[model samples]
Target: GESVGLHLPTLSVQEGDNSIINCAYSNSASDYFIWYKQESGKGPQFIIDIRSNMDKRQGQRVTVLLNKTVKHLSLQIAATQPGDSAVYFCAENESGGGADGLTFGKGTHLIIQP
Candidate 1:
């Protein structure tokens, strides 16, 4: 897949500060967007999601902004904590249905300095 290119695998951030995670997508036909946060070895938890019809969406201390015009998406975490430190991943689902799996980016490792 085109998304599987060589890329850096981690990110470091300080605690109590805002963290911004960026993602670049290639499929123009993709319509659904999702942001997930995984702590250590647990499964990814859904943080927020936005459809192509909207550009921004918010939930609790997290916000997701989608820019379909440029094929980009971002996840913003406010007041990052040591517990909040984890691997964040942004995913996209194409318009068509079926077992087509989610295309996930390399992910950003959020290191919170407590």
Candidate 2:
């Protein structure tokens, strides 16, 4: 289950164009960061993940960047397709706190335009 602790936001991008989704997390102690993509009526699917020790990580055509200094995170998707349209959100786990300590951010709806 996902947490709806804040207002939902939206981002629209054109098909074949690169899309960048930004997230700002508040837990300075968080050691792990994850990006999730959720289609309507479905569970959140893992996109990519990063750790406090690393500044960036990439998966397939997706990239995740974590800036602990500013407590910021962002996901970049290359050549987005219609299938890429979904609700994307970021989750973080406090240092030493495993999956059980995961905190979700307010999600943003990604819209792909052809």
lDDT of 1: 0.81
lDDT for each of the candidates? Answer: 0.81, 0.84
In candidate 1, what are the lDDT values of residues 10-100, reduced to their tens digit? Answer: 7677888898888888877888889888987799998998999999999999999988888889888999878888888888888676228
Which ranges of candidate 2 are over 4 A from the true structure?
1-8, 97-99
Compute each candidate's TM-score over C-alphas: 0.88, 0.89
Write one digit per residue (lDDT tens) for candidate 2, span 80-113.
9999999998888866544576689888899999
Clash tally, candidates in order: 0, 0
List pairs with backbone clashes in candidate 2: none
Please provide the root mean square deviation of candidate 2 (C-alpha atoms, Å): 3.3
Best by TM-score: 2
Instruction: Report residue 98 deviation for candidate 2 (angstroms).
Output: 7.9
As a TM-score, model 2 comes out at 0.89
Measured over all alpha carbons after superposition, the RMSD of each candidate to the real structure, in angstroms, is 2.2, 3.3
